[model samples]
Target: MDEIPIFIAILSFIVMCIGEILAYYSISLKYRYEFEAISFGFIFGVATLILIPKSFFEGFEIFVVFGMIVVYLIEKYLAYCPLSRKYCIECDNLEEVIKIKFIYPISFFIHTFIDGLIIAVSYISNIGLPLYFAILLHKLPAGFVLMSPLKGVYKNPLYPGVIVSFGTVLGTVIGLITLKNISPKILLAFSGGIFLGAFLMLVPHIYEHKKEKSFLYLLIGYILVMVITLIQ
Candidate 1:
């Protein structure tokens, strides 16, 4: 495993933790969410247009798209978990809602672990640095997305951040330790597909949640991703 990717992952994890903490404690709730929505669009657009294609040409194949679709469909089930009531219309009672919110963080733990594994596999193949930075930037919006919703449901800033950070660390360890063991073709293709699927899934969801979409933020995200690619 390359030290660069590992270092990047650790840094990304810390960035996310700090962002979550700020979001959890911040009093400007409205401004924060508005910013988050725009950030979401920007990240989604960038990932779809730049990161996904770059990843594919790096070696992920056409068949990997199918694998990604399949995995995404399966993962969608997690969205319906009781915790998802935060996004649902029919949810009632703070007590019941709070009971299930924990489920989201738990699932996030697993998701971040997979993210680490994907990073590990990619870096080992020598396609790691650019993808590593892409993935790292990807987490900033993700951290906001994860904590923003939970702000109302939980009191502690550390709660979600700690769980997410723990998950990231665990995944990084697994990825670093098992770097060479994973098959590059399958891991890269499949993981690449997964990343693409994630981007696709978020686009529609963002539009649905935000009736008035922020094209400016979306464009900024696109430009930022391009700049990151160009600089690298």
Candidate 2:
């Protein structure tokens, strides 16, 4: 319940917002392929290298799988019956619309909330600096990915950033207040599953435009994550 973790959480939220701002400006047709490719790679790396492994080590793999399946099913359902179908009837880009409106927001909220919780816990354990940097390394990309596809969905480009920031803040508050009584493994595993599902969903978009360059960017993104993990 110390104030240090709370302060670190606030800093993390600020870093994430910076990334979101950068992404908002980067959402253009010219860079769509590269953006998505990097996003896919980033998400993939996070799932395989970080989330999934942690879940397995903690013996919470089933929850990871369950989270993935839940995201997958929800995505499938949204494909046909989109949450904003009435408003977007004339829109041809149904997939992006669905993602921006539903999937990404849900996934980002859960994932970032977990990120905040982890930060709080790590700080409370007196091992927060390294973990904070690790989390910081990905926050930019995380924010970028969350904001990249949100152009047409929201009139105000800052909504996604606000949603993610709120989640992080909420998680931090909860972590600070109930650090002793709560077990985050299950939530961690489930969030990992959601990331995995979200990564799968990005596959098609990555290849939709610049096939060759997209693959290259994907590799770069994955390598960036790998490097981050190594440093940690």
Best by TM-score: 1
**Cα miss at 176, model 1 (Å)?**
2.3
Candidate 2 lDDT trough over 10 residues, lowest sum: 80-89
Model 1, C-alpha of 37: deviation from truth (Å): 7.3
Q: Write the per-residue lDDT of candidate 2 for residues 58-131, one digit (tens) a residue.
A: 56878888988976775555432243221122235556555557765775686678667766655554444544
**RMSD values, in order shown:** 4.5, 5.8
Backbone clashes in model 2, listed as residue pairs: none
Candidate 1 per-residue lDDT over residues 50-128, each given as its tens digit: 4455455444667467756754654565553343322332234333454336756665666677777767766776665
* Clashing residue pairs in candidate 1 (N, C-alpha, C atoms within 3 angstroms): none
Angstrom error at residue 23, model 1: 2.2
Every candidate's lDDT: 0.59, 0.64
| True lDDT of residue 38, candidate 2 | 73
- Give the runs in model 1 whose Cα sits over 4 Å from its true position: 27-63, 66-75, 80-95, 151-157, 209-232
So what's the TM-score on candidate 1? 0.71
